[model samples]
Target: MTEPVKLYVYDLSNGMARQMSRQLTGRQIDGIWHTSVVVFGRETFYGQGISTTLPGRSHHGAPLQVIDLGETAIDEETFNEYVMEMKDHYTADKYHLLEFNCNSFTNDVIGFLTGGSIPDYIKDLPTDFLSTPFGAALRPTIDAMYRRPSPSEPTPPIPSPIPAANATPDSQLAASILQAVAAHTQASNSTPNAATQTLYAPIHAITNPPSFHSFLKSHRAAVAFFTAANCGPCRMIEPVFERLSEEKGVKADGTGAGFAKIDIGVGLGNSLASEWGIRATPTFIFFLDGKKLDEMKGADANELRSQVDLLLFQAYPPHPHTSLSLPAVQALSLNPILFTQVPAIDTVLTRLSSFIDSNPWLSTTQSPGQAKQTLTGTVAPYLKARFSAAPSSKLPSATPTLLTSWSQATSAIASALPVASLFPLVDLWRLALLDPSVGTWVSSFPTSSPILLFIDKATAALKIPDPTSNPRNYLLTVLRLLSNTFATPALARSLFLTTRAALAEVVIPSLLHTDGAVRTAAASLAFNVAAFLQKGRVDKVKGGGGHAARDNTLEDEDWEVEMVSAVVEALGRETTSEEVVHRLAASLAFLLRLSPAYDTQLSPLLDVLQTRAVLKRKLTKGGCGEDGVVKKDVRKLVEEVANKLCP
Candidate 1:
């Protein structure tokens, strides 16, 4: 009744169709079939029929047709035309047929059918071959072929989609995705692996009225956080996060796993948050590219630090390029003290005793016990050697007491242990310097040690009375060190004015320093110098007695004049902050009062003040009120200087 379908079968040599015939028997498989020509050397054969074996059918069941177009030398175009002829002849039956061993034929049949190759494979054929008439018919069947359960394999159950009602929040979703990605990246060992593949996909939001996807494309490594404006935890940890980013050498622009903040409370932000399923506030999402790597919640600084470090190590191991070492303090050379014979114990003791006599804080007396025993046992031998030699012969009874105290103190110091020994040495030095009786002992100490140099200079600059002798030489030595030491300009400026010669050497150098702190300090020291010169002059006019007073009253005033001019020049040349300018202006005013004879030089100072006023005006226009105070101060100083000079 269905116009009994005519069966036309084609097969090549080696029985490819014959084999397929055995595979497709008994399943109502009524059709015309064509099979590929298998090529060996140069032989050729036409089609032939073979028996079919279909599912749930026996060997005696009705057999379907199979054809084998055996070994041929036909060109690709000829083979394609032959297949077409078969398709045209059997079009009416709407054939259900299986093609086998078609591997030798070029996919040109599809090209002829569609005038071009198809873009995708409908069945096992390459995409370019899928557009042929035969290919179109086979499309649905081929799709089913892939999904068909194999005789030897069990089928897996399909998963259902997530329900809308139980859908995750956008924030939570984003966090989850990030966490999953991070875990995958950390665990992945292959190049085109799961993590890299995932990174290639576009990230989607999980919320209603879905937001546009926001892709992360950083040139350097980075971790991005999508957050709300009012997130308290985010705010609290911002500084720490920034510091950690810097420590890891990550750029602010997301290089090397840097940090970037996104406010997700706005239009696009809300959409993205919804899409990412961010359920909680202050959730942090880590990403390597478009793919999320990890996520974190809550605001624990320590936990965040640990997580960041872990992730960084995973992404970039601590290889040669990423390794870091702590900076070391530079070393300095020290002078070697000369020792006389293999210095005997008594001689060393005597020298140490003399040192102690000059500096009394290092006492020999101690209570006996484990503590004292430990202390003496550790320090006694060294002390004995250090003070082993006597000063050939002693001078007077008074000298002996001083020498004895020095020796005992030195012995106590050299023999003492740890902080115990060091503390007493420092205490003794401080006491000796502060005391009028034995202050001369300080002169015997070397200024090579930075700590000792600082003390010596500070004492000299503070001008503690003269039983200590003039600290001029100590100050000079300290100045040399300041100029040469790698100490910061701030430290150098602190000790700039220990003496007249020290001031002369340090003031100019500090003023020219590139650092702002050094420049400001230099300016302050200049003011101090001006004050000192003025004070000396005033004292001289009032008949204070001293060779320094009698010899250079005018010279002191000239120095003040010159120093004030230098301050003015510096103000104009240096790029100082507003606060620094104000301070310098105030100092200039003080100098003006101190040296009124140099009234003409007040003009340049006034000009500097005016420049400061202009800067203040600009700042005010920009709504910076704090800087206004500095401007006002400078202006007042200017007015005062002008008034004093004119009056």
Candidate 2:
């Protein structure tokens, strides 16, 4: 049975309890003077002040009336710990006649237990009291008498110390608040890789098939458990169901499987379960793409868990590729647009003003930066001359010489110019690589190639801080250059044929950065890299991201899969900005194209996208209809990507 949380109103004064309101409202009110809450079924009641209630009636109150708050999901042990936590904060000596009293305590406890809070009318009583003429007249005296007690006044009796050691009340409420926050953090970390948030992810109580079916169609996999309140077997298996809901299986995006429960005893739940032909209590069903994959009945916890686990893996198993080898990849080419020089570089520079000259090196001071003026200046353009002089058709054969020059120029400019100032040089080099001929030239680099060495030097700059410069923006420009260069199937497939672990290592961590632009760039890079690795296999499955729970994974680790997993998790943690959602969505769509199996990995993020306000608004808003398009916000982009992933 659900416990009833009752609010007990009380009268502090004997005869004047009913008459006290005459001063304020000029009307007769009841005996209500003070208040506390009582929770039955837990065999415990709670209130403010240094006192306790033994399950039922309180020593302080007969009561004017009782108002039911709501039920709590907190178990006995956890509730008791919270009770003690509240008691320590509500020490009698700390209670003020107006400020820190029973009402404030009640609001805090009720809010913590359930997300619900006590009525605002009850909470506003103190402020209302102080606003009256009688209250104003007596307030100073009341303060002197009750607020910490004057030196000569008698003190309230202190409660006996708790039996536990280190039981001193935190002097500051902020300390208790901090402890509460830490406890929440500890709880979230307790269930590793599981969607153990207080708010369940992808878990809904469905009442009808049309609604449920729509959700099923949108996601890669879903697990529904048919249960009833009165069924003992259902009760027994509920823990197992909840555990699986929390455990992650496929990748580290904080999703195990789509989890939901429907009680057949309830009105809507009954029809839905009956429609599915579920006649037993605790019937567990696994679904993929709106089709039933497996089901389990009775209270056999192990079998139920195993079945779901199996489906989770089978639905989206890892197909790791140590190296990519695809004929389509080898036959790839680049767009003609990349070969065209950006004519707006000087315009952008002129707009940036004197800041560039003032801070020659945006983020790095390791180099002298004299070469920046020469490179950015119009008089002596070393890079432009060489790039223009070299024929675009002969680029494949000519790249080594260009690479040698690029390496020296990069080193010289890196030391002499701000990281931001290298945009022109990096930009033109990217444009040069757009020539279809470079595919042969790029793949020709040996492990001993100096070009690989320059890659390391460039990567180190990723970690450098540039407060004035938009590092993410600059990195975005660089990443686009790299992704475009490898957009061709042949060049992307080169990952499998060679050892380029250095580039992958640097790229993966960038996906986890807090900057939306950086993450967007990183995600774009992942999509480009993923195209090189899928090897033409596409399947769907579900997973959560963590070190454990390796399901159906073979010997060859899919480094691309792991990187995508990190992206899924990062998207879950991201809280700010719309642009990130745009880039992240773009990345997800690309990953989906890379492999249909990522639907399992990308599915749980939908829950996050729906719940978080920053991301949610992107999905919910729009004057446009169901068929209408949304703005180019991150969440909107994510929705588009979701369609691509599941479709």
Candidate 3:
């Protein structure tokens, strides 16, 4: 009936031809007739049963002609001539040329004979041909051949060379593909109408239910309620959920597309809950067309009402008349107490002094709220106004009068300094520090009894020998203030010269005081001053020249060397009291370790240590011998200093 389709297959290598043949046979083909060209002369043809792998059988039905150009072999011109002669003699459509390693020359022949159109029987090769391992090796040549233009026209200029197989696709191309897929998916889905809907579809329920496909078809938009029966908050929100559905005219019986609950009880699985990323009980999800729109969790009543109103507006836009403008409140009414004027300077100072005297705790403690109430509320407002309005020109002239009054008030407060009064005094000090005029008054105060004495006592309390009694927190605050003073060079230098001289005159001589805390505080203060000097904040005393000779030498360095020598000398004299010797040794060792420049300074100290034979001899006199506490403590401190400084 119909002649079997003569499939014109060409340029297929041995492996690809076999694969194509197998695929064709699987389609239940009847017979295959093969033709091969030996030359352009005597003809040969093959039957279906004959072997085509052999040389003679290869061209069984084709012509035998001896056409050889050279070892370099058939160029395009020669090939085209051979093809033209064959087409003139035989039906070109019935014969196909199976050439090996064909290039643009092969395409030229095909195009010339077929009018530049590929024959119906000549199917394109599989796309994976150049991707295979063996094909990959020859892919460049193969691609060149496929891309070659017809011989009639100059080979279309070779476009920019493609990158190698290892190269990845451009990022924009990948993103474009993804965006196209997303757009296609969105276009295929139905849009949800929020107007007539009661509740939004449950995101988790719809995504997880067995009948999810049917549910999505029936209800376009619904609300998903994620809750656990055991959660107290979830139980509390049940009434709110019910009311929201009723307001929207939704059936409470869960018949229509309304409120749907996903119970995450102990026995029930929560795979769906996790899929929707629900972290807490009473989480609500709004959905449209099987996609999540918005979510809310653990909302209070007012917050829930606002959310409901927002959702309703989105579902049903309001009429023009119903949308009324409301003016916003910008300022709150002020309380008369807060509005009261600042008190007179003298009265404020007097109240501060009186509060401090009545409550000893005011000297250190601070509570801004309590201080504000006491000063601004209890103190007469009229007197405060008078002092605030006083001319700046009169302030200097009035200083002595103000100071005398302050001194009298402070003495009165100090006489009855109770624990409750400390906070008020601290507030007064803060206010004084803030006000330039008051700060000047404090700086010039003649009596050191109240300010400096209180500082010394407080520092002593902080350094108590018993850990339980030590005011560690208060000491930390004092240290912070000391650090602040040293933050600026001018302040640090002034403080160093003043405090250093003070320590040398008053603090150092009192080391053997009755209280352990007093001795410790003195030592600690000395150590801090030394540390500050070591940091290069203070200038040394000068001679005839304006510049000091010891300007470049660090204060801590000189202090450490001097103190170490003093301790060694004290230990050697054997005349100094045991307590003094002990204290000196302890303080020297502590300074040696704490000083950053210990290694640079240690050699001189060690030399002194070696020259003093009495100290070394005393070390051997003890029962514990060389490893006793005194020798051990000194040796350990020296060893640590050596490691850190040497390293």
The all-Cα superposition gives candidate 3 an RMSD in Å to the true structure of: 30.3
Scored by TM-score, the top model is 2
Per-residue accuracy of model 3 over 1-647 as CA lDDT, tens digit each = 11111112222132333434333223222112122322222222211111113334342212222222112133445444544443322321111111111111222233222222222122113212322343333333323322324447543322222334543343232223323322321222232111111221112222123222223333344566777758888788877776665454222222223345566541121655776788888887765556676788985655555555554444332222113221110011111001112324455456655654345343323343344344444332423433356534443222445544444444444345532233344333323332344434444552521344334544455355765655443333233233333333444455555554333433443343444444444444444444455334211211111112234334546555655554454445433233333344444434443244544666556654663344444344341233332544444433333333222
Candidate 3 vs. true structure, TM-score: 0.23
List model 1 lDDT by residue over 349-384, tens digit each: 344345444543433463223323332454344333
Of candidate 1, the 10-residue stretch with the lowest lDDT total is 329-338
lDDT of 3 at 446: 27
Question: On residues 1-647, what C-alpha lDDT tens digit does candidate 2 reach at each position?
Answer: 45567777655443343444564445443433456667644223322233455533454436656777777776656656666644544544444444445655565556545555566555555445555554454344334333343457554322222223534442122123323322322231232111112122324444345445544654466888898778998889887776676563222232346676766754245667878899888788889767999888899987886677676655554433212333322232212112244435455444333434565453342243443343355312433443455545532333465554444545554455555555555555555455554544565653422334334545766666763444554455566566655644555556434534655665666776666666666666665555434333332222322123443331123554555555565555554544454445444444544353444544454344442332233465331234223554443455534443432
Error of 1 at 289 (Å): 93
Best by lDDT: 2
Task: Between candidates 2 and 3, name the one with more favorable TM-score.
Answer: 2
Q: Please identify model 1 stretches exceeding 4 Å from their true place.
A: 1-502, 537-551, 573-579, 594-628, 631-635, 642-647
